[model samples]
Target chain A: MAKTKARVKVPKSIKKGEVFQVKTLISHKMETGQRKNKKTGKKISRMIINKLVCQYNGKEVFASDWHPAISANPYMAFYVKADASGSLDFTWTDDEGKSVKKSAKITVAG
Target chain B: MIHKTLETRQVGRRELMAMFGAGVVAAMGVGMTPRDAMADAKSVTDAMMKVVGDNKPATGKIKLDLPQIAENGNTVPIAVEVDSPMSDADHVKALHLWADKNPRPEVASFRFSPASGKAKVSTRVRLSKTQNIVAVAEMSDGKFYMAKSEIKVTIGGCGG
Candidate 1:
């Protein structure tokens, strides 16, 4: 069975209107088409996680378009302002029409 | 085998068909060669032009952070941060990263909205050789910002 895990890191709680860092990592094998199969002398088709979008409180915050050059087990870090206590949802889509979703909740204290 | 003299030549339909087949095959061979040659023959500027068009970004308010020297090129840390208020009227729309010496110049692109709070992102990329990594940021106001840094790689990232 293939293991798919989405790791998200954020502060347990933050003051309202404070800026915070968000880190995410997903387990994936970003395959570039440059490699040739050893057993069969044919080029491997490129397949990678092409897009990742982050939404905070049901509003889009950050997104990315990735290429095959990104390292395997893709990792991305960005900053987001903590306004009110809400949830951050992430969706990662690959070239093969597969997508994985993950979300985290944060508490804002003023 | 058909032998003929110019003065008294004999024409055969089968011979004309054979000649036409060879011409078609030769043309196809020429067409197939360029595809393989083009795979690794694109320049950095050409790739960048496809994204930014004729607008060359100015240098400021954008920071591209990467190592000056990387022992292994397989994985090099890179971070791009832009100074923006992240307000409704002003924000970063997209960020494009590229390696000047890689087989393909464009590495990745990141998009941000005002809700992001800050225009900052970090990731890892592969380097083919010692070259400059360029970052171009497109803002909401239709202005562009640019930043670049060079890295020396001991071991190339792209496998030979």
Candidate 2:
């Protein structure tokens, strides 16, 4: 069985309405099913990170769909505006029905 | 006398035909080499094109920043930035990345909302070889833009 893991990094504190960077990386094999198994000599079935969703304070902020061509250990960094202090949850699902979730707290001061 | 006996026991026409047919089958199986892998790749591309319709026009506003030469095709740094203010009125809807020569052309698509505050993203992607990387940007007003760049890979990556 394949598994998915996510690592999220963001600033602990940010200013309201100010843009801050959020970086995320997911570990996946992302098999395209086009290759062959060296030992079995059979086609390896496709496995990929199918869906990713990000929520800030229970509201969806960003989402993406990944394909097999997405490199292994996919890393994504983007900007997010800090509107209020809350928890940002990130979830990703793979082709094998495996899902990984991680959350980070955002605190806005001044 | 031994030679005459062997001649008498020689294979019949039916056995000869069966042997020839078996040999032909074996040869045909071996002849179907993997050299024509490119044909399979073409069909994959055609499917991708159908998914990514021609509704977008190539625009210079989108910039795909990648190294001119990548030492490793397995993990190449890629950045996509669009010249747009991420506002509710005119924010970037989505940005799609594609590798022309990759086994799968649709590499990644990032969906954004105004709350994202920026139409920029950075990530790492796998490239099979030296090929063109294309980025398409969709705006909130149903308009599309794109940009592309060619990257040369010194070593073949993506494990074939």
In candidate 1, which residue ranges exceed 4 Å CA deviation? B1-41
Please write out the lDDT profile of model 1 over residues A21-91, one tens digit for every residue. 99999988777776778887566878788788899999888888787778778899999999889899999
Which stretches of candidate 2 lie above 4 Å from their native place?
A1-4, B1-56
Cα-based lDDT at residue B20, candidate 2: 44
Q: Please compute DockQ, using alpha carbons, for every candidate against the native two-chain complex.
A: 0.40, 0.40
Write one digit per residue (lDDT tens) for candidate 1, span B40-104: 21455644554454567889999888889988887888888999999989998878887888866
Q: Count the backbone clashes (under 3 Å) in each candidate.
A: 0, 0
The fnat scores of all predictions, in order, read 0.72, 0.76
TM per candidate: 0.81, 0.79
How well does candidate 1 reproduce the true complex, by DockQ?
0.40
